[model samples]
Target chain A: GIQVEQSPPDLILQEGANSTLRCNFSDSVNNLQWFHQNPWGQLINLFYIPSGTKQNGRLSATTVATERYSLLYISSSQTTDSGVYFCAVDRTLYGNNRLAFGKGNQVVVIP
Target chain B: EPEVTQTPSHQVTQMGQEVILRCVPISNHLYFYWYRQILGQKVEFLVSFYNNEISEKSEIFDDQFSVERPDGSNFTLKIRSTKLEDSAMYFCASSEDGNTEAFFGQGTRLTVV
Candidate 1:
């Protein structure tokens, strides 16, 4: 089992602001994913970066495996971005490939 | 894009009653999983199914819980006797293989009283 830690457990931002969230894992992982839980409780896939970087729309994520950390960036945030963002990882040694999740970072975006 | 689909977006059951949550994983996916998130808590893995059997399960998934792929397309989680603590958001997910990214459904909110 791997341990995941997400930073800045709570965040509040005005619309159009930019922010960055970080995830730190305790062990080497074969899979890492970022998810956004919307108000309706849908877990939307944001990124599946085990390493390297990726961007989609206003969201981007970077994973530095050597450092055992990942970063999610929100550029020019919108009110719709308000929700809980979670980072989950699959340990390389774990056979089942079940993800271990971190306590999410709750973001509140105000208009 | 292919995605997992869960039935009964929400459910309410009396304690001690049996409840089954259903899901349809992506057609091409071979790995299926069930995860739970209690209100204000982090998501936790419950079980993973492949080859029509459970490959791994957490301590949270005990004797009272079971999973089945009753058909080619349907995967279900059965709680024999629900308890108050059984209430949570249950998410069904699937991946093409054990090493790939798993996609999750919208989740079913189960309330046991």
Candidate 2:
């Protein structure tokens, strides 16, 4: 099983501020995704980047598979962005595709 | 976009009672999974189902827990006897395949007293 660790467990940012969250994994993964659990508890899919970089609106993510680390970047943050951001990964061992999630980075974007 | 849908957004059950959480995964998806998140804790995987059977399960999923795709479209998790610790937000997710991104439902909040 792979271990996922998210950094900056707690973050408070002013609206319009820019911030970055990181995720590190212990082993190689076949699948990686970034999710935002909003205040309403809806798990919104952000990105599924196993490698390279992807940008969606003011949000972007980069995963360096070789380095076993991924980063989620938020720019010009808004109050709506306040919630927990989780990074989950599925390792390739034994063809097991179940995801293991990180502790999550709790972000509070103050309006 | 198609998404996983869970029934009974919130449920309250007495300890020792059996509770079943239902979910309807995306129609085209082949892999389904159940995950739980205790308040103030990280999300943890419970089980994954494919081909009408469980592919993998975590230690958290013991004899008391079971999963079934009773119908072609419905996936359900059954807790034989609920406990106080069984209270959590249960999320149902589905993916097209093993190497794809999984989409999660809004989640069902289960509280066992």
Candidate 3:
């Protein structure tokens, strides 16, 4: 089993501010995903960057597989961005393709 | 974009009653998955289905739990006997491929009294 740990379990960012959240894994993984759990508890997929970097508008993510860590960047955040951000990893070699998720980073973007 | 859809957004059942959670994955998707999130806890994987059979399942999916594709369009998770601990938000997801991106549905909140 892989171990995933997220940084800053709780984060508060004023609207229009920028912040970075991190995820560290104990071992190498073949799959990695970033999700946003909305207020209503819908898990929305944000990025599936197992390695390298990807950007989506005001949001971006970079994964350095060698370091076994990934970073998510949110710029000019808005109130709607307030939610729980999760980093999940899948180790295919382990029996099933189950994703081990981190505790999550609870982001609060205040006005 | 076509997305996964689940029915019975919420369900309440007795401790020993059986419950079924239904999901309709993307029409073109080839892989399906079931996950549950206990209140205030991390999302946990329950099982993964593909090609009409279960490809894999987690320890939580004991003999009491099962999954099936009754027809061409529906994928279902069945719990033989529910328990208080089974109460959680169950999520259904589908992926274009087994080792690719997965899209999740809104999720069904199961409450076993």
Candidate 4:
């Protein structure tokens, strides 16, 4: 099983601020995803980057598989971005694709 | 886009009672999974189902827990006897295959008292 750790457990930023969140994994993974759990508890898939970089609107993510680390960047943040961001990984050991999630980075974007 | 859908957004049950949480994954997806998140805790994997069989499961998914794809479109998780500790948000997710991204349902909040 792989271990996932998210950094900056708690973050508070004003609207329009820019911030970065990080995720570190213990082993090589074939599937990695970034999710946002909104206030209502809906888990929204933000990205499915196992390697390289991807940008979606104000959110972007980069995963360096060889380094076993990933970063999520938020630019010009808005109040709607306030929630918990989680990074989950599925190792290639059994090819089952069972995801192990990090504790999450709780972000509070104040207006 | 097609998304996973879960029934009974919230449920309240007594300890020692049997409870079943249901989900409908994306029509074209082949892999389905169940994950739980306790209050203020990280999401944890419970089990993964594919080809009508379990591919893998976590320790938390012990004898008390079971999963079934009772129909072509429905996937379900059943807890034989609910415990106070079992109270959490249960999420159902699905992926097209082992290499693709998983899409999660809105989740069902289970409260055991």
TM-score, B chain alone, candidates in order:
0.99, 0.99, 0.98, 0.99
Candidate 3, B1-113: lDDT as tens digits? 79899988999999999999999999998889999999999999999988888998889999999999999989999999999999999999988787777889999999999
lDDT tens digits, residues B23-71, model 2?
A: 9999999989999999989899999998988998999999999999998
- Which tens-of-lDDT digit does each residue in B43-104 have in candidate 1? 99999998999999999999999999998999999999999999999999999889888999
Over 4 Å off in model 1, which ranges? A93-95
lDDT of 1: 0.95
The Cα error of candidate 3 at residue B5, in Å, is 0.7
Q: lDDT of all the models against the reference?
A: 0.95, 0.94, 0.93, 0.95
Candidate 2 per-residue lDDT over residues A28-66, each given as its tens digit: 998999999999788999999999999999999999999
The interface RMSD values of the models, given in order, are 1.6, 1.8, 2.3, 1.6
Q: Give the per-residue Cα lDDT of candidate 3 at B19.
A: 98
Tell me the TM-score of each prediction against the true structure: 0.98, 0.97, 0.96, 0.98
Best by TM-score: 1
- Worst lDDT run of 10 residues, candidate 1 chain A, spans A90-99
Please provide, for model 4 over A5-107, each residue's C-alpha lDDT reduced to its tens digit, 9 standing for 90 to 100.
9999999999999999999999999889999999999999999999999999999999999999999999999999999999999886444678889999999
Clashes of each: 0, 0, 0, 0
What is each candidate's fraction of native interface contacts (fnat)?
Answer: 0.71, 0.69, 0.53, 0.76
> What C-alpha lDDT, on a 0 to 100 scale, does residue B42 get in candidate 1?
97
In candidate 2, position B62 carries an lDDT of: 100
Give me candidate 2's TM-score against the actual structure.
0.97
